[model samples]
Target: MRDKETRLKRRMEPALTPWSGTTEATDWSLPEDLLQQASRRLSILCVVAAVLWGIGLFIGNSFPPRFAGLNGHPYPWPGNLVGGLAITAAVAMWLYIRLGHARPATLDVGLAFLVVNAFAIGLLDEWAPREVRNRSVSWIAVVILTCAMIAPSTPRKTLFAALVAASMDPIGALIAHLRGVAVPAAAETFIQYWPNYAAAFLAVVPSQVLQRLGRQISRVRDAGSYQLVQRLGGGGMGEVWRAEHRLLARPAAVKIVRPEVLGAASESDVRLITQRFMREAQATAVLGSPHTINVYDFGVTKEGAFYYVMELLVGRDLVSLVRVFCPLPANRAVYLLRQACHSLAEAHSRNLVHRDIKPANIYVCRMGLDYDFIKVLDFGLVKFGDRASTRQNLMTADHVTSGTPAYMAPEIILGNVETDPRADVYALGCVAYWMLTGQLVFQAETPMKMFVEHLHGTPVPPSQRTELPIPRDLEAVVMRCLEKDPQKRPDAAELFQMSCQCKASVPWDHEAAREWWALHLSEFTRGLTLAMPAAPAVSSSPVTR
Candidate 1:
């Protein structure tokens, strides 16, 4: 048995192995799917344009110049050339899309499309009277705008195409005049088309630049001491990544507020978010519960994005566990909730109320020989008490609703200013119900309805909601936590004791957790070994508090 456990630990140790020394962010393109989708859409548009041009050519050939209404200056050479070029360009685009060559080919095809169209329009402009030359430039400008709208080109490509297309008429007119054709002077042609050129650039540049910047930021790997390995998840405010520390060689998870979120916000809003981020990091770092996530490091990046590092966990959160194997056994639910209570009890004693306590924020990790170890996460929404400061109170005083609606307590939903540890107690009750019943205490379609139910509706007992036999003692404890009034709901310390008192057959203790993980999560434990040629000496940098 001793040898077996030793071999098990060896296999799992690779999962804890950290990647050494940080590297700078490398340039990478958008994913293949996005590039291919944009390319295919542009190629299809080219095919449609080619077919339309062929039909127009057939109609022109079936009649005389005067009867065809070509302004009595029918030039089949220019029309045939432009139409044939469109068809050839379509074929090239089709090949580009089929072969999946997106980068260089996209620019090449865009340039060809712009130059050929401009040259064709310039040739036809030679047939128009001098007074109509400026009018013809307007029509040609419209063509360029329409093509840009259909192409899958980036801002850089669009800008290049716009500049090349803008210059073509002036250059084409000069060449035509040199060949003895009656055309406007190069300077005059450019002056007339300048407005159109400016308009084309204005229409596409801003949106494209914003899009390109957003994509580039999302793919960034290096952010200070931690190097991002893979994106874990993201929300409206920020994103979380599985990362590793450089010198310490410790596996960690990093959460970062998207840089653009602050860059695009008003100054006051930016200040609020930054303050909130720092407060959260400090608050979480001060928490001393073994059930709370260990904060490793925290700081602002060089690019002005706020980020913090936490110990990376191997097991899934309660949300995932309930989703995959719910209708959890009664004792198992009690075991997990008791650990969560211990975390919240510590936070409450420190005058911090964790506004968000949903199942998703409560992770069940395999900590060494201990299985079913709960680690409460995301203290970013921790609300300080009135004793802190008027400024601190004003920050969250707007009564910004700050928790999952499904798990929110009545006081939070009612916008009460004095929300306390009781609010967390209510949320914990909702989590317990979800674990034992696989459904929320109250089911509603919209978030508003869920909030309304929390504010006014009574919660159904877990035993009545599901077929699973929830023990009477545990059921009583869950019901007590779900009480609407803050005065009635039990505090975390009391709930922790009550959960311990519940006499139910526990099936998710340390032994069961190890056995279950050996059967179901062995692969997750045996992680890939990240190469670290020369592991650096661990630094003694102090953690933020």
Candidate 2:
């Protein structure tokens, strides 16, 4: 029977593709958010350039020429025309971004605008009176340096853009000579243009530095056999990343705990945090229940960052489910809670107590032909027999509590050292309350106040808080689990049996789950694409106050 179950589990796992190193190069591509930021910066630069040009035009007309030249120089019509055109172009580019047309090709458009700005500066220089032209550092240098600083791109792309922009100085000089303007000697022109060209050449340094830094960060994100894709979310402890197996191409989620989070902690606290992390990975990996989140691998990176890879879930947690859809029907709540109970039951039978069991920790996802499948997650606070108190003390030493205050059991609040499986049972009951009413069991202004309510206040029944009709039997089971006294609460196994007995008006079944998902999650359902493996299948938030 065990072997048959293992075979079934393997078949249910996500498919993986053959290993390839080709995808690693794709990681260097700038994300859309970063590109958007670059576009905004470029737009701002254009506006600043336009304003500077307007100011220059105002000063030129209002004051006498501040250079050694004849007082009479035919209104400098060429300079005025070039300056006006530069201002117009800068304003147009700014408007282009402000009007919300800066996407799909934002980087390309920004680069083109940057090159135009550089060329305009060079033209303005060439059109200035001969006495003033090439007398000081070129404005083209400033533009090149600023563009390099603001916009990030590939080193090759940056080099090409900078070189093209720099060449505009010589090109402008050529245009001047062709237009009957007597240009300076070649040696003097080179002396004047050298700074602009040098600036352009040096601009690539920042791009190279940024790219090298990005590569280093990518390396740090790389775990044993998986590569971190993007961050899903983060909390006080660490971040969770969407990752994929490097070789097999199987999608997964990686949770990372960097060493810096413990930098301010004392040695003992650091040791406790490390032990807790290891315990979380070790405990979850050994659990045989399919309802529990599967751990595929865990290790420390070369930089001392700890990470663990687990199967990626494609659906929302109960918290989001309630937030989006409001209170769940009693039947559906029971369906999800039963699956969570199964996971808890397995952990409890093995002398493990999941100290944190809130709605956020209970995920409901699609599993092959099955819908509304629940997977229990976040076992970082799991308590083994006899060591529960010591671990709790270390966790609370910094004045921060262990389990979430909203779903914390009375025993945990009272600082009981030997909390049993009933603690998780109480927390699960709180989760049921949330699913039924879309509200916490107790409403308090602060975490401490919430803790006080859990300790001394009576919880309003779930049925009273919401318009949704919760079944009497299920309500009784939830209230039984919420009993302040541990002895009055049913254990995980008993709670599972009790949950199974509750008969809803319309019992949740496979067909009902499928129908519900199709109605509400059609987009996600339609987008699901399972990757096929070329090789044998390998078995795999919460606020801290």
Candidate 3:
């Protein structure tokens, strides 16, 4: 009952607070990808605006009224100045995009140009003919409002720019009046500026409000669906929660990560991590193997937190199982390793390398009638091959240490991100050794020492490391996987086949598994006191003898 109430509170929890800070644009305020796309589109718009400005200038000067007294003038100084500002802005934006500084400074440059253009045009209106001057402030306000709407900036920034631009027209008119220019009557001047301000305010307010509303709806919708039931573990990157879908009552595990956890990382680094994370989740979701954990959904929160939900398994991981039960018999190890191999085979076929595979990541679950069902977990450190073009490689580039030191393949430790499925094969061998001998293939006091051993030390065979009798075939397969040279390690498919051929004195059949679980989980089995049904025999058994 207490747990249910906690879940209810989590469900009722509001969406995370919208990011708060000064209204001024910052790299963290919006998604980096959105900024880049908006920057490119805005750059194009600036170039187009410049082109239109030049054409309008040419036509106005070629005709009479607008440029009557300015016939054969070298250049319309006021108009040319505004035009030059537009062209300069266009060039700067183009360069900014080409140089890849768009996210941090793109909106800044755009807003600067809009404000400057408004003031420049307003100053030009001071010398226009009475007919043009009468409506000049209104025209300038429209231009400023238009530019703000199309800028790469956020709604707040756009609205701020619109307000400032609109006010400039009145300020410019006041300056002209003070400078002894042939200004309009005070009432007329007031009427001209007030209407322009009103129109600009109306134009900007609705668009910004609608934008804010849309974002709010999206945030509420995202946070409304799932309720966290219990806290799972977390690491440097993210936290995991045991959660349930409100509508379906389906249990799941959700992993959540904040963009701020990246600490001092630049926008590009954060973007790369987000991209890699999504790609990893998508790839894992499609593995199609029953042994692979399933992903249900994934998305980012309004507050820049990333999350994904996966099927929740209620069972001990191989690490805990081995720690409590000591070294597993050769038959049980064969049973578990073959299932893991099936999962890895599917991942390998999809051109994914699960860079971090260890005992903790391989789960042993009791599923319906089947006990000791294997579910491979945690593909967060997967590396996509060149063939997997849909996913971009991390910009930090894979030279850095990424996987757990104990189980990481030697090739990965040596900074080879391009290492193939064989790297995973090696890690699987380490896991197999740990399962068979109740210890890692190599033991060291420090990570560096372990890395050194994995890089240069020869691993003792599983059979030699333990008194328990491991099948010769299974030991050979495990030893081959621990080979330092990746080329020497058998691929996942071959390992699967070899595990199928391994012979053991006592095969861990379904009945044996059921009996073992009944003893280990006495309280769980109390509701099933009826006589157990006869179990089916293994056909083309993965474990022999």
Candidate 4:
């Protein structure tokens, strides 16, 4: 019997040899289906976010509690929500981020929808009786549902958000029905409760979020001296992960390029792109300020992927923030621009131009009672003043242009590679224009038209476009950056200094923006947004200059 058992164990040994390690097979590599599901969910969330935000703002601004329009509820920061539905969507957004799962998937669409309708129902304040509040929510749900029907490019998220709003509506209606209102068929009640029930859906919701972040984090292993966490984002080229220093638990961003991309490249080409990518990191990584994201390490993985670690930011991108409350006040605009200039100038000093300087690229780490940390990302489109030929070019990776066309300069569209700091200056001008008006400065009907406008059409200054006060210094800076002539534009470093000098009413020590805005507004007060007591209107002459 012992001999037979030994023989059997010997046969089983080969099977266990491959997976002898601690982690499971799926742990190292994600399943195809899981990836597809995550990707689809992300796409759906994108579509849903676009729709819900558009409607939320419209309903929020158009409805009662009239102050809520545009810059509605007055929530201290950006926009405020007087209605319960808008508040609910905000809560879902809050939950999404805190849990480290702000994917805004189909599930979020449904949750956002529910939150909006629920908010409108007066569930939180309940100014009137429970039944009255419920009825209000039910009515709001109808309006939300109708909007969803008319929306273009409806995805799973849109459907889900609509369903969520619908859930609140039925419950409100049911309460009214219970109070002896001549109700429709009992079939409607059964239908409301069909898919987890609508009459009281909030009871089951509110706290049921699948924060897979912990699960993702737990999967990281403590190898060597340091510990590693879950991966953040990567494309066909590379991946980035969060890691902790062994000695100090300080967090860092670890960027990685998979072996396949590096391993197969010729040594010369590999060195070229590697050097460029590293140069990109070094150029902006060590700005050495809270406003600037700090790069800690840059190295290749055991598998031969190149990686760089930097400061991991917390908070939404400026794009998300603006969608809620846009057309920032001139003083507020100056404050943000000044901080951005500080960082960009540092890059410009090294002759580095951040080609992709869009709202999505700027992250707001902390919105202290009045201040925030803005970290820039995706400098892949960076231009090195002296080094023209990059490893990316050597490989002939793809034919597509490196940067987003919307932000690309006139010189770039004309296929100018010797493009210097002026290209980035154009992008910065575009960003400044966006903040002041909450609209793209060179917006045309199509991408083709947008590109053409950059070549031909003249952008109207912010002062002329919106009600906001436009500082001449700020105006000079934007126009100079957008100058058709590259030499006519100021290098990012010079621009940064100008920004620092232009808005100086507030001391660096004084972080109180409200007081700063109030004081500065009196000097050069320009109103922002389409709402409020309305800021003073200002305009500029059509410039052929």
By TM-score, the best candidate is 1
lDDT of each: 0.68, 0.74, 0.68, 0.52
Q: Candidate 2, residues 1-545: lDDT per residue as tens digits? A: 45644653353232111112122223234434555677788788888989998888877666655543643232356557867888988888888878876553555566677788787777766754475454778788888888888864666667788888887877777777777777887678877788888987888887777666654454445466777666667755767766777678578877876555544335555555655666677678888899999988776543344567788776778877899888899999999889999999999988788898987788887877789999898888887756754554343354456888999999988877777789999999999999999999999999989999999999989889999898899999999999999999999999999999999888999899989989987644554465522111211121111
Alpha-carbon runs more than 4 Å astray in model 1: 1-171, 174-222, 262-265, 390-399, 525-545
**What's the true lDDT of residue 513 in model 1?**
68
What is the alpha-carbon lDDT of model 3 when measured against the actual structure?
Answer: 0.68
Per-model TM-score on C-alpha atoms: 0.63, 0.61, 0.57, 0.48
Clashing pairs in 3: none
Model 1 accuracy (lDDT, Cα) = 0.68
Cα displacement (Å) at residue 430, model 3: 0.4
The TM-score between candidate 2 and the true structure equals 0.61
Cα-lDDT of candidate 2 = 0.74
* Candidate 4 Cα errors over 4 Å, as ranges: 1-241, 257-276, 285-291, 367-370, 387-400, 501-509, 514-545
Write the candidate numbers in order of decreasing lDDT: 2, 1, 3, 4
Candidate 1 local lDDT, residue 79: 62
lDDT of candidate 1 at residue 16, scale 0 to 100: 27
lDDT string, candidate 1, 1-545, tens digits = 45643543353332222212112111113345555555666677667767766776787566654444334242475667766776777677667766766653564476567666666665655544454344644545766676665553556666777777766667656756766667666677788779668756863654375456535444343355777766666765677777767677677777777545554334455556765666666678777799998876666543445677788776777777788776788978988999999999998887788888888788876776677888898887788755554345444526577778999998888876767788999999999999999899998999999988988898888899888889999999999999998899899999999998998865557787677767866644443455321111111111111
Best by lDDT: 2
> Can you give the lDDT of residue 498 in candidate 3?
87
